[model samples]
Target: MTFIAGWLPSDLNNPSNDNIAGPDSVAIKGPTGGFLVPAGATVSNIGFHSKNAVPAKFSIYAIDFTLLAETGGATTGGAGDELFPLLTDWTPQVDTYVYVAALTSSYLTGIGGDANLRFMPYASRVYEDGFPNPFVQAGTANTPKQALWLDGTLAASGPSIPEADDITDESQPVTFTLSGNENAPTGITINGEVGSNLIFVSENTGAGTETYSYEPPLIADDDTTDLVVSVDGATAATVIAYTNSYDRDQLTHPATEAEYSENSLSYPNAYATTQPYEWKVVTDANASVVTINWNALEADDGFHKDVASYATPVANGSTTVTLGVFVPETGQAYQFDRTITVSDGSVVVTGEGLWCELFRDPTEELFTELFR
Candidate 1:
């Protein structure tokens, strides 16, 4: 949010009104120009100044001459300035003409009968052509004056996120786009977790479109998460995304031959020697139940029938086994194949034995056996 102070002519003074004879009689004065507030801008307060240290009441009107806001009352203290804050914030939808009327006080006669007050509207952001004049005074009596000007400190608007939609894929990382409108956001979070990979697509004077990528943890199907954007430690926008239904295609098995090749059991004693087989299943979705089926292999002792760690007996010849994996979260079953080969002690016993045998028997027959 931006802070715009004194957004109207603060130097303009109300002329003396002798018609306001007493405290009951009021002389209403307005400007001859108006200001245009930007879309989404909010008017927080209006400022008043008295050149003659006189007390007065102010009222703000819209371009249609409708009453929008007003001040209870304000008096120029020793500093000759006071702020009349609104009870509720006001946001104009279209071009608004902020008209301020200074109702005379009993001291009007004491202060040379001149109200001599200046009024300025304070708002968040101003449009490019919001203020048309630097100095504006009252035109006609109670005809809804249009004069406007701005003073005091000026600031840029806050950051914003315009897109708020659900994501389709939970397995893939998501990127959220945000607009740093004049002021860059200090931080961003997803599901209360800090986001990573913050990249700015373009930056110009602290304003640009930035992207934050986040890889969600394993979540259950149809679950939702929130991506919140914050500025100055205040939450500005929140985007919700739901995980899609679990699919069998989303699960992957990253098995390698090296994992099983090093655990091959010796022949003849293959039943006594068990080969450790642990094939992990990787997925971005939660799994309530997981089961592994070791086809054509003798299973050993383990939890859940060796779903995570499988110790199986191997034979002499090479055999292919299809492992069936089931996930209760998806209610689906998947399969993967792995081939195991056991040494019969014909050429070599182990990896060290094979290298030792190669050094002793460096012939074409040994070379062919090694390659085969």
Candidate 2:
């Protein structure tokens, strides 16, 4: 088995001369003629060594420019610090050449500052049969030289509206501002729609700013979308927006009683109860009013009653009442149903015989009746 060590400068004697400098810069190294990873070879513990204690972001690419991996951000301890960030092991199906790009923090300043940060890949690989050394020069002296160190900051601001804010009106357009070094933003997508009218204001060696105005599409109420900004084909920032609508789970109604009991035989049978039930729906503050529809109550026996009166009729069997509401903002409707059972006086009399009955009612009323 072959054990490959960390990266080394092409010229081991003049190592200090190869250190690149920048506050925000991209450094690329690789495609070193020989395979960095042979087929079926396993590479692990991919990391880098830093000359300065500074935070940095890294993106790894294949020889064909396919993005392989990325380190969102990592920090070095001090000079000679080796940072082994958490990275998944890689076993390529075919021979591969890996390239790396490092973007140092903008906090770097002079030769001795964080801007003078230098990085070299440190990885271990296991492969059968030794391969050609992948060592290559670090600076501009080589054919595939590193990209010029960009010296500026990357930042984005404003959708004019706050993130995740509910929008009742779609006529109002949102705006965003992207400012940074040259070649900072490659594309911007709003709600999966590409943003148009990209206007660059100021562009110089120091910094540049661009503006993007987006007209939101008509989305179904209660739906959500987002705007994304990309740098070097990678997501840099995002802002989310929501459409005002109702929350079905928040619908409120009167508590349903499992059963209602009646004791007086003088009362009419299968009568509509005078008790009223109110059904209500909840929605975003900016949403429009909801129209409630009280459908007819359904029962196993007895006549169906109009629920528009907000009252349920008492019957010997179970009755189901359905309530529906339409939300104009979302152009959607919701429904809820409840079942109610009523039981008449629990006692029964039979046979042809003169008898006297006495029973206590639900309200503690004593009733005495003669049956024949």
Candidate 3:
């Protein structure tokens, strides 16, 4: 988050506690910080905090100052000061806790005002369930982290709790690109929270372009780009803000080898790949019943019976799939039956025993030997 401060035209050369008015002490919810007020602005009063989840009130003030115009016979006020534009004093209603007082101008660099431009000290409110506020009591050692408990309530235990979202001003989205090295593989896409995708297309023999698109369109004052990147099955990469684009600075991310490999089968002793095996299956729109037929083959393994029947089929597509089975003493795979539902748009497919599978000998003896 970027920082913005109020400006005024007071010379701080003479440290006089008697000159200022209203609450002299200021508290900030974020981090302790300081800023300078441009000339001519007066220090009025600063306030913070409110009952709303988003505090309705926040402000700051300054004192005795002169607004000197950019063009003037420079008035020398003191040893540590130079002359600037001067103006009269006035007060304006606060808006969204952020207030600015300066000569009206499209640009902020050059302007002067007499009234105090309120500075909203950073403020935040965190509410916990059951608990009245954010602070935790001293005796609650076993309390779940991030969990809220009433002051005198019984200690509760259950699932781990999550903290509330941090409140902050929404940020704007930034457009950026990434250039990959010539040796890098193409077709990479990075995703951002805003539903933007950075696609890497081989534009030339050596480089590609990464573009960003909003998922749900962005709104004004909203943080536009919370960058997220996806590679070939590895954990996604997080891109930094302000860094819109990066030249492939050496290979930091790469595709997984499993994503690039192929599966193969070979004969037992013939040392050749030749097969006339035929496999067939059938099912309704709702995968209620499924049957498979593998044409008879020379039975090398005791499981040459090739009519594979799946009471149920694997519904979800996964690069790696596993079915969990428990054997009391000797661990072994077992079959189970369950109904499954499939949906695409308005169409619905429902079938019973859709996931039942019998794990017998491998279809190929060499394939069976590899696992043993």
lDDT of predicted model 1:
0.39
Question: Who wins the lDDT comparison?
Answer: 1
- Those runs of model 3 whose alpha carbons end farther than 4 Å from true positions after fitting are 1-4, 7-369
Give the best candidate by TM-score: 1
Ranking by TM-score: 1, 2, 3
Per-prediction TM-score: 0.34, 0.26, 0.19
Candidate 2 lDDT by residue in tens digits, 166-256: 3444456555655442354555565665654444443222223445455455433434466666654456454565453322221221121
Which has the better lDDT: candidate 2, or candidate 3? 2
Q: Mark the 10 consecutive residues where model 3 has the least summed lDDT.
A: 144-153
Positional deviation of residue 35's Cα in model 3 after best superposition, in angstroms: 9.6
Model 1: residue 186 alpha-carbon error in angstroms: 22
User: What ranges in model 2 sit over 4 Å off?
Assistant: 1-12, 15-25, 28-81, 84-168, 179-207, 221-224, 228-237, 244-372
Clashes of each: 9, 1, 34
Runs of candidate 1 with Cα error greater than 4 angstroms are 1-32, 53-55, 74-79, 92-97, 102-159, 162-372
- Encode model 3's per-residue lDDT on 1-372: one tens digit a residue: 111222112211221222211122121111111223221123333211112122112222222123211121222222321223222222211111222222211111221221222112111111222111212112123211110100111111211111111112122333333322222222222222233333333232222333332222221112233343333323223333222111111111112222211120111111111222211111222333321121221122111111122123334321111112222123222222222232231211222121212313223443444333
